[model samples]
Target: MTPAARTHRTAVLALHYQNDVLHAQGCIRVGLAEDDPARERVIAAAGQLIAGARQLDLPLIHIRIAFRADYADLIQNCQIFRQTAQLGAVKDGTWGAAFFSGLEPIEDREHEFVLRHHRTSGFIGTPLELLLRKLGTRHLIVAGVATHSVVEMTARHAADLGYEVTIAADACAAARAEVHKASLASMSLIAEVGSVASALASEKDSR
Candidate 1:
């Protein structure tokens, strides 16, 4: 991390399942696809450490999945909903259905909220933006798996909500690094993208 930024409030959201879950975790993983394994591992580690820091009294906001029984909306809006549900990709009331383990569940934590969504954006079909506003969060640092999907979606919503968003580029792993990069480039115009260390350093400097 550098020493160019101050410590700002951050919210970390885990994108998919991981080693904390069973082998059937989730389809989103690194190296196993067109993504870079090394980048994935690094981002995962950064997220883990950030979670730990948050747990240790550092300012951070955490978000996770809270599945609901109603997949009807998804069924109507998205065609893949039923198909992925059949594959048990994101089954309700299951461990794999929750957030990755490295991320501490915000369940009982302060300024924490769980958002259940049938789509990619956590803010979509959910009151994520409201919760963030209540938490007095002006800055959001996003880091998670599947850069092309969840990470991108959330960042876009954040921008629309007028939040200063920053994506931990290296802290995100995806099935396609190129696509992830493309998303990052687009997001940078709307938000900002940086490595975890660089971001942390920038945050520390801001403080």
Candidate 2:
């Protein structure tokens, strides 16, 4: 990628560092892991990705999942979110809906954008496209939780929407190792799949 183009790349953290997903007592933490080596590794990689993006001064876009208290905006047809409704997870204004501490953008960072979505894809029903266009984002560096769900869906959607997508495989997590690997394989067909270090290195090389 050209240096000018790479300068417009956005680092998207999709539901990775969120209370409902990454916390020990989180409602959906069961979908990933707790006190496990794989989970720890994933978290560490994602944290490094965030730190790298900050070092590069890239736009940091934090995508979170949240629904209304009454679940009116949540579609019951989506099987994945049914568990969220049942468990009362990610309710707006609750701790479960907040971004994890030490992982979110600090206040007064003008380039940092936080988006709340009720569905799997970040672009769906969100101003993400408009924001990206406004920011002139040509590529996306994606890292998130539940590789088979939010991470995969967002990467595919971004690719189809004309944005170059790169999946930080090491920075993504799933309910199981097999599932995570499967998701990465599937995503590799559509987007570049690599570790956070490689992604950052690619950016630097491009520059």
Candidate 3:
């Protein structure tokens, strides 16, 4: 990690790694093949980051998008929200809303938190910012699926909330390469875009 990260309270924010967003049969996996290398790469990179956070004793926060079975909490103000409601995706209590294989929170882990939201940004209608403040988290290391949406939105919001955000670039994916690249470019303006390894590196290693 960078010197700034070593001096500040930091946390890992893993967003939208649910089956409904990354699994083969997921409604949101449009334009991406089940065996897409990009998807696999993101899963692996994110897994590594999570493991690293656990070893470093950093808080691990898993954020997912889920709605009531009746879609009562879902707002259809955007195309993605409307599609989610139409496809009946990410309903609480369903397998699709579960975290992707090997990425789920460890049961009973004190530092691991799982939060559910109904919107694109994890902070929207959620206790994410409050939780971060309680944890004394000034620096955020983020990794997630759909780089162009949840990841981008959350990073931007975090920056605006006065948190130093670092996005694990390789740990995030989108339906298309161009979209992912564009989103990353946009986020670079407000956040540090780096690889998982760099984001998780210790200060000694950096030296």
Candidate 4:
């Protein structure tokens, strides 16, 4: 098949790099060990990815998962959502819902945007797609926590929405190594699987 024409407009979607998921005191860090090398690697790589995006002047969109204090708007269709309220994790206005250190959007920056979602995919129940459309972004570089869920689902949703999707594999982490590997493999079928370095290089080259 012939390759699609490059649009040159790309944005980075940083999802779920919140304190509740990455912090040692996070409630959602249940199965994730505080000292896990894989988790640390993800944090480092994601930090690098964000820095690279900023240096390249690419639009950076930080997607977070947060619910109301009582979670009245939260859907309970999934175990994760159900457990969210029980664990009191990612409650809006709490530190747990805040972005992790060094991974936050620069306030007052025109290129940096923030969107919150209650579902697994950033596009669902959020203005992510609308914002991307307004910015004329046809290509997306995605990185986030829980490769099996948010990363995978959001990339898939972006692909289905006709946006070229690339996953920063090294910038994503899961509670289990095997699950992370399996999720990346599965997502490869729908999105380009690459590391933060590769994604940055591609963006630089495109410019």
Q: Please report the candidate that would top TM-score against the real structure.
A: 4
Query: Best candidate per lDDT, number?
Result: 4
What is the Cα-based TM-score of model 2? 0.92
Cα displacement (Å) at residue 1, model 3: 34
Query: What's the TM-score of every candidate structure?
Result: 0.75, 0.92, 0.92, 0.94
**Tens digits of lDDT, candidate 1, 1-207:** 876533336655544433322122353334343343564465466565475446544445444433444544445345435555554455567655655555545567554455666677767777777666555677777866567767788888888888888888776765566877888888888777887766666666765
Q: What lDDT tens digits, residue by residue, belong to model 3 across residues 1-207?
A: 645432328899999888888888987773579877777877899889989889887889999888899998887998988988889899998999998898889858878899988787889988988888777888899889888888999998999989888999999988789999999999999999999998988421543
Tens-digit per-residue lDDT, 78-172, candidate 4: 89789888999999999999999988889687788999888999999888888887778999999998889899999999999999999999999
Q: Taking the tens digit of each residue's C-alpha lDDT, what string does model 2 give over 1-207?
A: 645543365555545478888887888873655667776787788788888887888788888888899999889886777888999998988999888776876657767788888788888888988888877888899988889888988899999988888998888888888998999999888899999999989988887
Task: List residue ranges in candidate 1 displaced over 4 A.
Answer: 1-10, 17-36, 39-43, 52-59, 65-73, 79-83
Better of 2 and 4 by lDDT: 4
